[model samples]
Target: MDPEGARIQDDPDVKVMMAGSTLRKVKSRSWKKQRHFRLLEDGLTIWYKSRWAGRGHSTFSVTEVEAVREGHQSEVLLSIAEEFPADLCFTLVFHGRQGNLDLVADSPEEAQAWIRGVRKLIHKAQTMDEKERLDQWVWDWFQKADKNKDGKMNFKEVKKLLKMMNVDMNEEHALHLFTMADKSESDSLEIEQFVYFYKMLTQRDEVWKVFQDYSGDGEKLMLEELENFLRIEQHEGEQSGQHAKELIDRYEPSETAVKQGAMSLDGFQMYLCSQEGSIFNPEHQNLYQDMSQPLSHYFISSSHNTYLLEDQLRGQSSLEAYIQALKRGCRCVEVDCWDGSDGEPVVYHGHTLTSKILFKDVVSTVKEYAFKTSDFPVILSLENHCGVEQQTVMAQHLSQILGDTLLTTLLDGQVPQQLPSPQELKGKILLKAKKIGGLEQCLDETLTDEVSDDEEMADGDPESPCTEDPPAANKKHKKSKLSRELSDLVVYCKSVHFHGFEHARSHAKCYEMSSFSESKAKKLAKEAGTDFVQYNTRQMSRIYPSGLRTDSSNYNPQDMWNVGCQIVALNFQTAGLEMDLNDGLFRQNGCCGFVLKPEFMRDATSQFSPEKPEGHQGYKPLRLSIQVISGQQLPKVNQKEGSIVDPLVRVEIYGVPQDQAKEETSHINNNGFNPVWNETLNFVIHAPGLALVRFLVEDYDKASRNDFIGQFTLPFTCIQAGYRHIHLLSKDGTIIPPSSLFVNISISELTSGS
Candidate 1:
């Protein structure tokens, strides 16, 4: 290795070079070219040369190497579909478009060494990227804090900076940050050291950091102070004053309380990030519940018009949509298939100007990403606009791309008394299209008798351009038959027509599924709410956005989910309040896209409604008292020169609310660096378990709509119910380090409840 390249070579993880490794021409899958590879600071670099082959060197961005693993030599060679003969050598595999670089090592130990070294490099690169991103964020905040642009921010300037970032800083917390950033122990911080201050504030990321700031010592937490921090600082005077001591004892038992006062930062953080916070509760019982029940037993994450990136008409439909949906834990996705000009079936929003892609491409993409984010079964909600010939092609493509993963029969070959659980269908794909054989022919007797395999066809999705009502009895309408090739793929998820609660009970069988338009489902809820819940108990029901959602906006997923609709489908491409609520609800339970239904809704014999149940009284109205204390490193919207933003912190509560649901602080100007509102806002919540709190940071502008900086929304159950720092995040949901609001939150049962 050259002196300049020696740094990577000298890495403790790096070792003796191996022999017989070469780069494969991806399209050709050839190994004729011998190559040498090394890890550079930013990426993986490779060199190849041969007598007949052109010598070249190239580098792939570290992020481009999506996956790396040790591989079997002969098996790997055969699997890559290359023409290489079986060889008993060690191999390493890197999977991605950056080129599937397969390297042969001299020994198994060498292969392991390479795998370890590459993984370490990948991790280091990713960390560095994140740190760089944070540095840029800090610089932006720094520039905004120094309004005068004198290269440094004074104590007053730093204080204002904290307010802007939604951080409430006392003299002590502020000074610790300020003096540390000023290595000179000076009274100010240079712009260059702003990121250093940010690291100090966020690196520990322990609740104790903030707790200590509010305590007498910069380390020890006092009982009285903890109580006040909970009651006064958190605006939660109603909470038990001894709450801190209890949490400390439960989570950080290693540390005994002080003689008089008790608590520590470690204990508090453990509680905050625990299931108690409603954040990452992997141990929650709901997540580990029996996954062996039928698919309908879960509130599955679903998407409508998943192919369209924007508008249904004139919008571009791409495979990316399927990948995006699958990665987000969407267990079910819609595809409208029409005959393409190339004799293949194409997917798009039919009868519209939406662009199209080969149905095969969608299938391939699904196969790749279906289990990437979650291992739950994926349901393909097929909307057919194609004829029999291409429909067969579509089925063939699915069968080919998905192979054994596509479910073609009941797992146990027995008539299911109930639907199988997601756990049972792991790595499997189910089709939610209509069956035309014994089921779709309206031969009710066939369903009553021993069921035979049926030929299935595509169902008319509500938003499908070709969707139409069943032909009237008076009208002589010819029926279309599904080819057996495509029909065989519709195993357990056979889509069935539902006439109503009564019709479903009388005609629909257990395995057949139903789809309902929003209006129809809402009508059912209003008239036969209990009956609908009963119907959903044994069979699957899908609710899609009505045709009226032309702009691709979303309906309230909660409304349908409340009724136990398993597949409450939405336009996954759109983002809004409805989408936010959907994300929040499904974010739990491993984000597997299949959340178990509530006990009341899941009980087959119980009659339920979203509103007050028959024997139960309505919920008690609750009051939330939230104090907007101060912000630290509040992000500014893109502001022009000569202008500093006025930031406002809004506390918006979403749920079944009886009155106006939001309150906010008056704008604090020029203090984006450290905004201090010290304002208390209150709200009366009607739905406690169904409630969510969203904290938004905005740049206030008089002449224009308030520009959004960022926000974070989490279920009310996640709130720590004490005085804790509320970390702020970017609009896209990435955390903005050192940026958070210091606030007190108090929840009380309303006395006005009748």
Candidate 2:
């Protein structure tokens, strides 16, 4: 059981939840109906059903609930605000892309009771240790198997449960284990008996073999033996003894084992699955990177068409999207502003069927969540399609809603030679839009003639009209007039046209930046990789996805980061390999939404090209060897009964042209648990600093494409050399604990092939 859950039953909120209530489920203005919701006896699951919908009920685990928002935070709740009081409303936000559940209670007290109770349960679920989580998993399975609610599962039910769990066990062996666990002489097994039977059925023989290799006795590991294993396998040099003792104290379930300074097999498995055994270095988990560098020297996390929750064409525009992006530590968010009939500027994809949100609400949402995840500056990339009158409303909304958080004036009372550091401008919102003139002109006059920035509307953003137009056709696309009220708010990030490398090198101001479509940026990176790298050293550049991606898909952000592009914006709503790479690159630096570029990429005079990295000066290749040892509790790609997965591991390297490679292990037949492949894949990385390593597992098939199981990606620099476990994540980046790949990693300077 979880230590946090021990006290939860005594919580006042949980008591109130057990009593239950009839709450109004709010889906839209017209769809407000009463639903009876109550906490189950287990205290970890919530049961709900509509009074009218007979024989139809549903249950969601507390672990699946990510957060509970109070009052009108959700779009559904806001739609029926007049029908329900703010104090009586709340929303339950789930993990991944699951839609939120908005509800309204009869009283404020009842609303607070459900909100606080669910939050308590979520906290307990999140803080569970590896052993506790395993226990919970077993309990959940038992609940499913015991369909008759008799508190027991018979042999027939157990057989069905095994198939549901992706296991194809021999019937005779399963029967022998089940008979051993059924000590009460009854054919059916109780909850405790079921747990014992599961332990016998899923015994990790692979881990036992490893434990036997390290232990003198086949049962437990002594202090000296555990210390030796840590030094040799975990590379824990001087602190091996101390770390071993700490592990024994933390993981050893038996008090006798702790007193004897020994670790049982259970304790050893717990330690190996803990955060300390993760492939990522724990030291890099905190704010370990230098953050005082100029803003141009860092790669900023950005999102394109951030207001849309789905495809660019018919997506719903919601403030929740902005809140979600900011919570993920995205430093830049795009808002497409158009003239609304209500005299307020609206944000949505222009000339499309996407819904609209008030610009003021978006600014308000940004102000609330900008610094919640990181104390870094946020860049508001405004795609302005509104005229002067509505533009003033936008400026007023920004200034009023954001208040002191808005960067309306130049920092240090002067234009900077280079952009200010994130640390210097912490908690401020910077506007990245068209400015009529330089900083001097903005401070000097009330209005100036609008400058024609060709690249301004050519970003290929979902809202830009000429995004997909040909160059000849782009000439006929009229530019919107810039309002002095809006233009004056742009301080450091002034949108300007990109003439040429030579022109930018000579005439481009430090405060001026340009936006490029993915195609144009890729062309520049390939043709003049060195010049692009040099140019980015002084001025920032933003690369957005092509407008042709009507589905709001993303390009490989690594292509832009190779050229030192500061803000490589992608559709945050989409989840795939592209977003995985983006999440991997920014996972370090405390996830503060900024990572400094490599030393060569930061130096203006240094020559480095992503296309020809081998030719760079002082290039030294390093050899990386990864031993794909085994897998643990791999998930089934198919949920059908009796469907076991044939799992395989693929290791991919993403970097410069010469460093990109992929290697895979042979698939094991009909196994999703404890499949071993002691194959070592090797690679030579010329630019290790820019490399990202991805470990992907799939259900291999000969007749069709393999099904994705899970994957984990991280920067090569963050890789720790040792025997580590790669905890896999689902497609949406939520961790699926216990689903991991065990690997031994080694890195050394490249020598002659041997």
Candidate maximizing lDDT: 2
| Candidate 1 structure quality by residue, lDDT tens digits, 549-590 | 778888877667656788899887776666666776776667
- lDDT (0-100) at residue 470 of candidate 2? 44
User: 241 in model 1: Cα distance from truth in Å?
Assistant: 16
- Segments in model 2 whose C-alpha atoms lie over 4 Å from true places: 1-7, 440-443, 453-480
lDDT of each: 0.65, 0.86
* Residue 481, model 2, lDDT: 71
lDDT of 1: 0.65
Model 1, residue 622: what's the lDDT?
A: 71
lDDT of 1 at 583: 70
Worst 10 residues of 2 by lDDT: 458-467
- Give the clashing residue pairs of candidate 2, or none: none
